[model samples]
Target: MPSNPYADLPAERSWRRAVVATPPFALDPTRPGDFRLSRTERIATAGSCFAQHVARVLRESGYTFYVAEPPRLAGSEAEDNFSARYGNIYTTRQLVQLFDRAFGAFTPRLTAWERPDGRFVDPFRPRMEPDGFASPEAVAAARDRHLAQVRTLFETLDTLVFTLGLTEGWRDRHDGAALPLAPGVVGGTWDPAEYGFVNAGVAEMVGDVTRFVDGLRGVNPRARVILTVSPVPLAMTYAERHVLVANAYSKAALRVVADEVAAARPDVFYFPSYEIVTAPTTVGRYFSENLRAVTPAGVAHVMRCFMAHAQEGDRAATAALDIRSEAMRTSQVICDEELLDA
Candidate 1:
């Protein structure tokens, strides 16, 4: 029998001796450059706030990427808060729902606004100017039409990069749909029977992600996946008397999922953004006032390391064909505040 090459190696130094080094902010504990993003590849991002930053960076860097926001409705009072106005993809449930909608597995929901005159309002009209969609039926039909567009968007994506945020989330009891945020905060309402608390474990998360990847592949075989765990800690926790414990649980579960996915699937790659921020060796000067918001400097350093590593791998892959060339690249480092403004 062959002996394990690392069996006699010192456990402490094993990781350091390995070819890939772990970055500071990684929650998944994966080494850097495990997966390389090609310059020609199309990328799409979803998941937490950090995911938005990744999307923005890729876009600014002249990469092909998609950031899908909710559709803008005419005359909506809370238009700014609407999902359509933001590129956030909401909940993990929504991610799966997008795939289902694309493959014709489920129908989209339509909602209508009612006016005092017992008539339907026009959703497309400005709220100050007129009543919204005239009737419930009309509103419902309009919703379905909007959902079709969303379906098309998902179908067009070549690679979906998702950053896992929180393991604890609210879910619907009747159908097991996950809510993006607490119902009252956004447009959705909360109900006892309709909503339940879900703290996903490592297995459940892996299952959710695996199913999502498989479903997407079923429709688009060339579609690839990249997963990252959010470094931001939970603002609050539902666990009994221990918010810290809850945060640990959430991050640990997400890390496990990333590892399992990377081990099981060749197409599924794990990115170490979480480690890039959290590494003890890296300067803590990059955190915001809250200590959780990774600073702009930190993000730039992380992305710089990532881009450099990716470029190296690309060069190595093409070097054998004598097509490698040294090229100069320029980039701007923006702070978190600047990112917010952008």
Candidate 2:
């Protein structure tokens, strides 16, 4: 046999020799030359509930987890936990529409939804007001203010960490904007003719996200995006197929988009938190009993790997942060989709 270029490569490049051959604790999926974070970088998080974990880790590590709109409530509930109060942004179209609305380029047709008691909720973010706004005028005013803050988030942050949560979402037939949840699920009444389910394919995901990135960079040229897919499976699927089958399709499509988008842009990077938590190699120790929520151990392991490859100064600064007290706080994430379980 002739000696070829593959003769003397690092073991880390070979999955079998590096992962399967080594013990589970030794497995490290991240590679060198990946993007590194600086201690001063302003990182804004949006997307599914899983993104909340990233925000928490950033705060606890002494990194700048940019917050454009602080919560108005008091006590533990006050921490909305993301970069802003714009609840979970599950779809790329929703994120894009948010940018458009902030700049007054696009206005959704279904502005506010009314409840039986006559309270109104913004279609874009229903849960924002648990008791619901007093009227449609109030809903509009609140949404306008929220979008302004979201604009600040887009314009000021150095990095945006967005997690792709679902391929399926509900959208209005009129303006074609994505709604955070199906109308009836949270506040509004169900109007089958007015609302429809969307299972976005790879091309649509690519187009929507690409447009979102372009728009974001147009305002803030220095902003970069870090893409991630939520490893937690869907709480429920409206798709006619079995829940497991629908979930598989949803994740597969989103993962393809993640890979494609990251490859298309140099500034955009994909972090494999999804792979870390869901890989069969981990022996499924990362999931809770319900097999939906990620274990605290899993989150800690992921953050450790992320901080390891970060800038040296950032790593040292993060290490010196007061994490012991915050570590004692419970990890109870507020996910809208989890409502389906109820």
Candidate 3:
């Protein structure tokens, strides 16, 4: 036989044979990388709920997990796990819009959403304050303060880890700003004329995410990015097709786009948490009975892989950190998407 590249490849090529013959968690496919991390690096995490696990583990491991807007409310540390408290950023458009709003490049038209009791919430982050603010002025003041912190997060962090969650989202028709949740689902009134559904294709997501990373780098030239696709399926879909079919399409698109962007950018790298949890070898053990929430065991495995590949310094510094405690802290994570089921 000719001595081609395939002749020297590892057993993971024939790796599927073990999956077909053996049990779950047996065929690990995590690819090693040169994406190094030091204990001093200021790491920021965002994206779907799964990204919270990354931040939590980093914080608990004694790593510098950057937090620009620290929650002042008592008992809110666990809930405020991200670089900021922006809840599950599900789409690339939402991320870019966030950066734009932070820098005052974009201002959403639907500023405040009125509640039944006449109180108002920030339309961009309706759930940021669960009880709602006292008035429109209060909402505006709070949003401005939050945006200032988001600006700091973007400009100061050394590394940014973003998990691509969904391609489906709701956006404003006039301004093209992305909403975290649908207008009616959380606070604002639903107006078909004012709102539009968007299932961003590969090209759109790639463009938006690439622009975001490039913009971040422009402001902070030393920043590096790691992109991961959330293995958790969509909570719901607006597409006319069956939910299962829509989920497959959405996940597949995100996975492909993430790969492409990571490949195109020298500083951007892709991680395989999606594969670790969703692979057939795991036999669905990583998911909760609801099949959406990731199990603690699954989270630990993914983080283990990440730490193994990314962390290169002071490994012993975080070795004593308890994964159980980290898991407990993450259980308090607030995913805005779950409100869709409510």
Candidate 4:
């Protein structure tokens, strides 16, 4: 072939050499990232349901897996769930709004949602408290404590790995703040006028993510961000279009947003967890029977790809963690979105 820009590229640049010809388990698609995780770095995680996998693996592999808000109560559900008590943060808008709420820039008017049984759930985290809080006053108190922990997470963590889960979500009509789940699905009554559905476009996703990173660095000057689009598909979609079509657009748009943001920022980088599990080379081996849940094999493959590039060569912390035992616990991940499973 005639020499050209493409001709001179390495074998890894070719689709056939890099993917088609490689064995599924041997495949490693992660590029050289701008940063690597040392065992001492305070690592934190947030984002959609799939993010629970990232959090668990980070903890199991002997990394810092920083949790700013530990379970204050003896038998709290937040043990391996959230860095702060905020449940699944499914959109970039939710992530940005979280920072604003933490720093006192915004306060949502709908602080609590009343369940049918007369209990109230925190609007920010509807599924967090089982049976809901005793009163809105109790909800407010818990939130005050939660946001305080969130502020600490923002200021102290060295790196935050945020998994972008979806572009479709519900938001408040007045302030346009994102809500984790749709009203009535888990708790709260759905009113047409109170809440509005938002399907974020590429520009909106990029803007929100950029705003989040800017807000994060303002508090912690040295904070680094690792952006990854969750490979898991949406459990459901609110759009009139079929769930399949909406999911395709949502993932594609978010992937572009991640690429654009990571490329523009020096300290921010995009990891390819999305690419690894969703790769065609896997031949659908990465998904469970439902075609939505990621199989343990898939999660392990993603972790292997991450360790190959992002983690430092430290086996000391790995000594205490039983990888097989941890794998069994993957089924216990608390995904708020799964409430729509009916």
- For candidate 1, what is the lDDT? 0.57
| Candidate 4 CA-lDDT value | 0.84
List the candidate 3 regions with Cα displacement exceeding 4 Å.
1-5, 17-28, 312-323
| Cα lDDT tens digits for candidate 3, 33-113 | 548787798999999888988888887677798988886575575566767867778899999989998998888887799
Worst 10 residues of 1 by lDDT: 321-330
**How do all the candidates rank in terms of lDDT, highest first?**
4, 3, 2, 1
**What's model 3's TM-score?**
0.93
User: Model 4 segments beyond 4 Å from truth?
Assistant: 72-79, 312-327
Q: Estimate each model's TM-score.
A: 0.70, 0.92, 0.93, 0.94
The best candidate in terms of lDDT: 4
Q: What is the TM-score of candidate 4?
A: 0.94
Q: What is the per-residue lDDT of model 4 for residues 1-342, given as tens digits with 9 covering 90 to 100?
A: 758879878777899998888888878777765568888999999988777877877876777889898854544533465787788889999999999999999998888889888999998888777768999899999999999999999999999999999999998898897899888987788998989999999998899999989888889999999989998898888899999999999999989999999987778988888888889988898888989888887887777667656654545443434447655766777777777876
Q: What C-alpha lDDT does candidate 2 achieve relative to the native structure?
A: 0.81
The residue pairs in collision within model 3 are none
lDDT of 2 at 112: 86
TM-score-wise, the better of 1 and 4 is 4
**Tens digit of per-residue lDDT, candidate 1, span 148-200:** 65555556677777878877766657666554554433223456665677787
lDDT of 2 by residue, 1-342 (tens): 539877788898777888789776446577665777876989888999888878877776778889998875743342557677778888888888888999899988887898777889888887767789898898989988888998899999999989999999999887798898998877788888888999898999999899999899999999999888999999998889999999999888999998998888769988878878887678889888898888776766666666665554465644543334334442556688988778
Provide the lDDT at 283 for model 2: 89
TM-score of 2: 0.92
